[model samples]
Target: MATPYIRMNGAGNDFVVVNALETAFRPTQEQARTLGNKATGPGFDQIIGIEPSDGADAFMRVWNSDGGMVETCGNALRCVGWLLLQSTGRDAVTIDTLGGLTTARRAGPDQVTVDMGRPRLRWDEIPLAEEMQTYGIELQVGPIDDPVVHTPGAVSMGNPHVVFFTDRLDDGFVRGTGSLIEHHPLFPEGVNVGFAHVLAPDRIRLRVWERGAGLTKACGTGACAALVAATRRGLTGRRATVEVDGGELQIDWDQATDHVLMTGPVETEGTGTLSL
Candidate 1:
């Protein structure tokens, strides 16, 4: 039998979502790759499996195109929220994942706002091998003396990230160095790398090199993670506009709630059925 799936995009980062609330089939790593293959199969950056939640509203399993299981995926979660709203007729939905619980609410006709929760900032939480006094402390990478951009603020949004602040978005050194820092030995579990240029007190231009997905058009959790890092480092305010390659996202670090709220748009890029 063929399995039905929905193709969706949040801030331009695409995904394939499968509802397994009633089924027991869990796609293997190889199966996930086959489903994500653009040439011969359904193309997507990640594949999301939605199962019954133990305590929360639902449970999500995320897999990158390369067949690697990921702890969290912000863009995919927004897509899940859309699906949940359609299926349950509820404006608010809570999703449980390996990372933590994420709450989503309908913000507009086609937009969803998610509370991504607090970011983990300690070196141990980021799970880095060594301890750094502060997340903004500098680190060396490769043989490039006077390294391109150091002193990045590290945070974990269920996954690890390093946010490097720059004066200009078009700086020449980010691309090469981003890859280097992503695999650097300092981060034992590897990390998603972000290059951010603060355009204003409440706006930033950002680019990301994901841990397992490489350079994607946009990343929802990355934006939230970056905002947390920037605010902690005094580079920007609690609320800011993060501009990615595909589009923009409004991120607010609500102090009262102690959660990161990410508001963004999602698109339906048609649907397909896959036979495994």
Candidate 2:
């Protein structure tokens, strides 16, 4: 039997969602490569699998376009949360992932808010090669004396991320510099690189180079990380509107709960049956 799939995008980060509850489907590395290719398949930054869960409403599994499985994806979770909400018509839904359990609820039409959980700030959590203050790690690009980018804030939103505060979002700079930092010796387990241009105390312009997905339209965790980093640096308040290449995401780092709340929109581009 063919596998049914939903093509969805959260703030322009596209994904191919497979409801494993309805049809059991898991893609191999080769299959993921083919399916993620815009030429060969529906094309996506990541493919999400929604499976049954005993602890939560559903278990979400994520795979990058390169077929590398990841711990979690914030945007993908929002998409899955929307699916569960539609299916069960519940005010809120809890989804379990390799990272942990998170809850999502409706904020407005097509808008979903996800509790991204508290970020891991310890150096070991990010698993840097050596111990150092994650608030600002010593790394640089360009030249030794005059580096283009330096002192990035490191954190983990289920996955490692290094956020650099910048004044601009140059495509070439983001791709070239991000690719360099992603595999830097400091980050033991690869990392997602974020370039953020703070617009105000409550707004920021951002871009991200995902670990396996390269440059994407938007990164949910990257936005959350940026806010956390900015707040730590006193650049922004606890809450802010992060603007990405795709759209805007409202991120709030609740002081009381210490959990990052991400509010964004999810879109259903199309649906199809996959021949697996």
Candidate 3:
């Protein structure tokens, strides 16, 4: 059958979304690899599926471009929230994900906000290979005499991430150093590597190499991870504007609730039906 699909992007992180709440539609990893390929595929960072949820408005299921199923994608949550809001005429909606339940609301005509939940800081939670300090684990790149980047702050925003604060944004540092650390031995489940340059206490220029998605224009969870990590290290405040390759996202780590809030925009690039 021809299943309807919505093509959406938050900032520049794109997705191919399908609704399976009323139908029995399961996405295979093979399809993800095909749909996420830029040269010969549909070209998306991830594939999102909306399914029936007993706990929330919908359950968000995602598969990375490398055909790996993952727990969270924050931008996708905002996109789904907006879709439900548009359909139900409600400003707020709760979404169930592999990560957990996330509450989202309309912030503006083109902007949406999602509470990403508190970050997981424990080594066991981030699922590091061994017990160590997550803030600065025993990991490094380059020569021992002078490493390119080291002592990153680790945190899990439903997914593992290691954030490196650099003095400047270098293409070599972001790509080269990020790639090596993604598969480092310290992270048992692998990790997303982030390169961030602090423009101010409330502003950062960031880039991420996702666990299975590779390099993306923007990663919502990655942005949240960056903010929480930076704040924990006293580098930034609880709130900041993260400028990714795609665009900017306003992030805040609420002190009272300890939940991270992400605000951004989602665009409907186009709509079509997919043959499955």
Off by over 4 Å in 3: none
* Clash tally for model 2: 0
Residue-level lDDT tens digits of model 3 in 93-175: 99999889999999998799999998999999997999998877787777998987778889998889998888646676677
**TM-score of every model versus the real structure:** 0.93, 0.98, 0.96
Task: Encode model 1's per-residue lDDT on 1-276: one tens digit a residue.
Answer: 898888889988988888889985477888888777888688788888899987888899998887889899988888898889777889899999999998989999889998899878888998788888546855754456666577888888898888888754553455667777878888888888888888888998898888777778898889998899889978889999999988999999999987899999989888788888
lDDT of each: 0.85, 0.93, 0.88
- Against the true structure, whose TM-score is highest? 2
Who wins the lDDT comparison? 2
Give lDDT for model 1.
0.85
TM-score of 1: 0.93
Candidate 2: regions farther than 4 A off = none
For candidate 2, write residues 1-276 as lDDT tens digits.
Answer: 678889999999999999898666778988888888888888899999999999999999998988888889999999999999999999899999988899999999999999999999999998799999998998888799998888989989988999999985889999999998889888878999999999999999999999989999999999999999999999999999999999999999999999999999999999997665
Q: What is the lDDT of residue 186 in candidate 3?
A: 84
Per-residue lDDT for 150 in model 1? 71
